[model samples]
Target: MTKYFLQKTLSQSVSVSGTGVHSGKQTHLTIHPAPENHGIKFRRIDLPGTQDIPALFKRVVDTSLATVLGANGAIVSTIEHLMASFAGLGIDNAMVEVDDYEIPIMDGSAGIFTQSITNAGIMEQTAPKHFLIVKKPIKIVDNDKYVMVYPEPCFKITCKIDFQHPLIGEQELTFDRAKNNFEKDISHARTFGFIKDIELLKKFSLGKGGSLDNAIIIDKDRILNEEGLRYPDEFVRHKLLDSLGDFSLLGMPIQGHIITRKSGHTLNHLFIESFLKNKNAWETGPTKME
Candidate 1:
């Protein structure tokens, strides 16, 4: 198999402004190009002391509702979707500066971030791309919920979600990263939540930025949104989207096929943590295809 790696970036810096999903505080996010090998770093501009949080699975300190990364005493929350956009678009180096702990939910999908990054254009850099290649199948399970990664030439995901709600029964979705169809097939699948869970989330002071605009609201029997689903299997597609973002936290593009069922942020992070811990199962090197 041939390896492939390419450094990439937006043509210029672009900023987006919105309210954080959990904090409910207005925040600004700026995406800028960084030097090669810099990977993706998040800078907390709002903190009294400036600190950088490397978007790595190891730095993940929390994965409740969203993924949170902390380093040098600084934390950045809800970064999975943004990282997914970067990974899906083949962006290798970026500096994500944010003024809050969480990124704006931004319609609860990766479409906006993908569109903005595309508008900025992709510029190639000289450095070779680095990739983590899975050499053996690895699996993690928590009861019936599980995630498994198997050797593949390129990044891919197969996700299945089973919800008891009538609006989203059982659905499965797949993505072939090398085909570059992320924007069309996966990006617009919005986040979703049950009506019964709203009050619970609020009690925990979470989902403050959530609304019909950013998430699909599912009641007992049907969807609460006037407009129907974006895709018949949107729920599963959104799960695949979240998997892409969560896996991107590996700090480099991955080469593997991921199979998941009823997995969420916590399970995704567990898979990554296990991958990192079991180095013998994988190896990283310069791409053979430049």
Candidate 2:
């Protein structure tokens, strides 16, 4: 199965323009094909630096509001959605150029990035893609939240989320990348937060660009958005989507079954760090894609 895959990247350059979620500044992003082993990197053309930040778990310097990668004194924040798009599409190497410190949270979902990349076309390279084969179970716990990964034949996730809101209670979502379409099942699901949270976030200068157009805002027992929801169980689906993106920080595709319960970006980062610390739990080499 491992021999069947070759490294892949975009066939041509593609770009998008939007407003940064945190910076609240208009931004532009461009993607270009990179060498076989180049992997995914973010270049801050707006910043005075030459070191490109690598999209890897070790480079993660912060996971509070979003997954942030820092290297060479430069940092790129809010990259989970784009990273998930690359992982779902099996893109191996690409140079992502951003004209800002943060990525534009387009619609607060991976759908836009996924569709734009598809339009740019995907091209395979000569090198076989590498994957992290899970050999044993790895888990992380944060208060009542827990995330665990077990050995499996392919990439899959079983996620459970709970919210105090009426619209969102206890919800569970199970997804297999091989059987389920990432774009259809998870990519379009937008990020969500509470109305109270938006006010509190603004006090601390977070989610500056967040609005009903980008995020699903829930106020008490009602949704603030006029257009209901894309999926009835979109809340859990978005969590699953986030988990997929966070797990991609391992720097390669993963072959395992992930079971998570109310885990967020911080916990996801901790789990990845734990898995990498245990040298015998995973092996990186040529692995087949679903």
Candidate 3:
């Protein structure tokens, strides 16, 4: 048997400090262990007397630049990376406190967060973990981008991306929960963007903290970073990383197969709404280890 069916949380608190990619502001974030069934919730310590924003799809306020969650006039932006780290590690409950409106974009990947939580160690609770088990297919599409889920005994994700750039033309990767390692295989994939888009974001005062050190920047025909790609298909893997975070807002782990094609945060959020509306397509209960 595996621990996937058991609820878990951090054995102790862990913290990280960095700059928010879009806000260009330094922020401190700490993840504290929570009792069973608490789920992941974020509190903006900068705003006193505000309610904690539950890390769930219904609380998502914006997906234009990143997954932003809001409650009681308080907001937490760029949370997908940290949320992905929680989901990837099978962390069932945590209390994340941040000193700003946005979570820091640590190296533009979940590696640091995952490593911190792993070093602190994960504690398993006696309560059973509930999983949303897909019983039928659910899908949503926007233009040429689409996201879909199918019944599966274990969690799996298949991501595909196609860009006109020479360095990253077309790439696809599949991560099987029953077989793959999330930290080694997926956590280090960094967020990427084109040079032109970065310039435009700067014009709008967005992505002000984005740099080669934090994100993989692409020039017209080359990568702007001094170091090259982490993996041959790092681009698609990063897309997969984003998908993992976006879907984590489902409020519980899913036992299903998710396939995404050219999807981003917006499309992923839309698919989550569709999945929730189609409740008959899935059943919720304790998952059995296959």
lDDT of each: 0.87, 0.89, 0.93
Which candidate number has the best lDDT? 3
Between prediction 1 and prediction 2, the one with superior lDDT is: 2
The better-scoring model by TM-score among 1 and 3 is: 3
Q: Which candidate would rank higher by lDDT, 1 or 3?
A: 3
- Clash list (residue pairs), candidate 2: none
Candidate 1, which ten residues in sequence have the lowest lDDT sum?
Answer: 1-10
- RMSD of each predicted structure: 1.9, 1.5, 1.4
Give the 10-residue window scoring lowest on summed lDDT in candidate 3. 1-10
lDDT of 1 at 153: 80
lDDT digits (tens) for residues 129-151 of candidate 2: 88888999988888899999899
lDDT-better candidate, 2 vs 3:
3
lDDT of 3 by residue, 1-290 (tens): 36547899999999999999999999999999999999999988888889999999989999999999999789999999898889889999999999999899989999999999999999999999999999999989878889999998899999999898899998999999878999999999999999999999999999988999899999989998989889889899889989999999999999999999999999999999999999899989997655
Between which residue pairs do clashes occur in model 3?
Answer: none
Backbone N/Cα/C clashes per model: 0, 0, 0
